[model samples]
Target: MLPEVPTEGRIPFLDLTIPIHWENHAILMFGIWFVLVPFAIMVVRFGKGKPTTYGIPRGTPKWAFPEVCWALHFYGLYTAILLALAGAGFAMLLTGGFSGSLHAWFGVGTIGLGVLQIISAQFRGSHGGRKAPTSDPDDRTTWGGDHFDMTPQRWWFEAWHKTAGYFALFLAGGAVATGLSQFWVLGIAIALAVVVIGGLITAVVLQGRGYNHDTYLSVYGTHPDHPFNRRRFAQMLEEKDRKP
Candidate 1:
């Protein structure tokens, strides 16, 4: 059995007496990883505007519906990162530096991955497409952007950012599990299970209903001349030709 924490006093650990606000820490971290972060991910995953050639003109105001999804995702994750740092800092301060425990290590790993996600997004290159202000819809020559051309920079950014974000969440699951093992909160534990199951069900339903559109097709459109589409089409033809 775990040792009981005394009221109005520090909790005893090996060679250390640490001040811990268990309730506050649990609430803050639970809301961030379980509630806010998942909401942001779900919104971006299923809330993209339907794939259309003219969808979301480049200069469309940021407050618009589909555009707002991106805003929520961008700002929501930023908020989570900041709050996570604050929570972790407070805990570390009270604990007098790292505890070198499993929970502590998991939290550190989760936060490190979260910070890297933000830094990677900053270098995602430019947005250039048919609807971009710098491009003319009638003239493909003006569509000269890293994204429009599927340049190496943009491709690598998407590859890393998308994959890393999910991996960070996986680490967060580990952190939450380990944290609860150390200081179990029944409410938070129940909420975590409900949220995970609900999120999976929601994703399956939305994906089956065709809500998970391709990022390129949703933002840029299905124009045959789009660089990415053209390349994909060429590759498909080559694969077909190689078949018996």
Candidate 2:
């Protein structure tokens, strides 16, 4: 278990870059880009896997991914807020308004992109006829809805979301590099971390993009009449053999 954080003597956000609060800055920076961002991507990736062993007919995509996405969105949202707040704190402490550093600009860009992402999600509706039918009582695919955006708009939304995500991740890396420049982080270490993190995010996002309706339903079709049920089909075959 993690050690309990002491309530008293907590370093104020404005003191984030002070020598005494270096650890706080390090922790916050790592928490946002490394932990939260990767966790969100992994959770969505996990939804693309088969869940036959668990007997979850809807698989992780239908039942678990949305729930995870909902929870992780808060992480992304608040982290973006914290990034802005930290910048504002720094400005208040020293710069009086905004630091003209490239890092500061990148941080601002990240927050702006995150806000755009959130707004785009609000307009998202079903993707063409791709939405899971609600007429069936057993329908369990739960991510999009029947009222979702049109294909062309959804396509643009996806394009923007993916592009912005990558840009934000890169900007976060730049921000961390600048933020930690006075610290012990080596140049080589930063480079390696960026490459590894960027590669992983790219891979996971690509994998998620490949999980179209056919791919998803093939692995975990929950519809009552879907032909994807191998076990049920086998049983039916066995019963038919016995009947004659």
Candidate 3:
């Protein structure tokens, strides 16, 4: 609690009261959601076939990662935006304008997540492409190439991603439940937790099947790596040979 006495009717900078619910708001919305969204998306995308090789898409862009288990970019962006908003709101709260405990906690949680999002984006966007740090490097790739280095392995990357996913969900859920007292907020928080958890479980079960990395990189037809599968390269070759 901050001292209410202010000299000359002005609260001193050192006496600013901390927002009551900063941890819940910032940690939950930004911190948790920042990591959770991408994790959830990746679980669906990569886990579609098998946990390791990750199933290939029937039709996929050549630039895509085959075993991408989730799309964290969305979560990153959403968390960042929320972080900014919460920071502003926090300023108001500290200056004696706003004073909702729920709002404060959520704001703090969200801001923490926003910082994480920025860190992740910077790491992924370093090579001028949106490839994550764990993505496999294209065999023919270089610094000036159109892709970055990231690949799925049974060790580090998977562990980081999975741990982040579970932790984020828990933080987001618990923050809402414990920090906020409003009825509507409670309902929304519980609903969000349920949705995230359900989606993750379903996607993981779907991923147990064998995943083929080449499948996700094929453009229009079967992958060259696939036996008896016609390839897009054949069409490209044929088109190139056509006389104008």
Candidate 4:
């Protein structure tokens, strides 16, 4: 037999009940974490342009196609975090407080990591490059942004943000699994399976087709004189020297 819908608690102002709140929370979190967040990550990962400056000129607006990938990732994650907080707040209010359950912990951890992702992004430093608005394409001296130079700050930020984002998604999956155990929603379960499998397959196909261009090269082009590229090339030469 299916589990009965929870209808005990009443909404604060309106005539709605706890089940409505629960459903809303579930839908919001599911859509944010499973659908929207995954799509954003995938787009940013595979939607970057080729590592050539032919089509994308210097000082192209950040809202353009290839650059827009970062914009989409930025806004999508911000929106997800905000909606997640709202959904979590609603759930907490309906339940009176945190119940210390495994699901509750998973939910809290996921939301916490989402918040950290936003906070870390703020410290990702500047985007100095030949393509930056502040940079002069002909003046290599002006292209000194943290990302362009691959400074320690930017490197650490990328390391934490990318890894933690994936970890947060893993926690979200745990939350969803535990939530399903409590709510027994067949629809949500099926949706989870479909979204996870579909996202994996799509990511694999895009990667196979060489859509996953290097982020640095995509944004700054393949100019060997670029600081990061220069450093990378030097490192490769050093490694080759050491291989003897």
Candidate 2, 117-207: lDDT as tens digits: 6777765555221233442334334423322212455556667866877787777777776666544445435654775778577776766
Model 3 root mean square deviation, Cα atoms? 12.9
- Please give the lDDT score at residue 87 for candidate 1: 95
Clashes of 1: 0
The 10-residue segment of model 1 with minimum total lDDT is 1-10
lDDT of 3 by residue, 1-244 (tens): 1233111222356764443444344354534453455454454555433322212433344335533333344454555456556655555545466445664565456455545644544433222111323334352132221112222232243345445544654555555554444323544556566666876675566556433233223211233432212334666778889957
**Candidate 1 — which residues are off by over 4 angstroms?**
4-19
Full-model lDDT for every candidate: 0.83, 0.52, 0.43, 0.84
> Residue 239: error of model 1 in Å?
1.5
Residue 34, candidate 2: Cα error in Å is: 1.7
The sequence of per-residue lDDT tens digits that candidate 4 reaches over residues 1-244 is 1254344656666766645545556777899999989988998999898888523567567798877998898899999999999888877766566868788999999999999998888999998877777878778798789998899999999999999999999999999988877776678889999998988899989999999999888887787887888899999999999995
Candidate 4: deviation at residue 187, Å? 0.9
- The prediction achieving the highest lDDT against the true structure is 4
Across 1-244, the per-residue lDDT of candidate 1 in tens digits comes to: 1354322333335445654668678889989988888888988899888977655676777778678889999999999999999999867766556878787888999899889989999888988887788888778788879887899999999899888888888888988888888788898889898999998999999999999888788888887878999999999999999999
Model 2 TM-score is 0.54
Residue 108's C-alpha lDDT in candidate 4?
97
RMSD each, Å: 3.7, 11.9, 12.9, 2.4
Against the true structure, what is each candidate's TM-score? Answer: 0.91, 0.54, 0.41, 0.92
Better of 1 and 2 by lDDT: 1
Q: Who wins the TM-score comparison?
A: 4
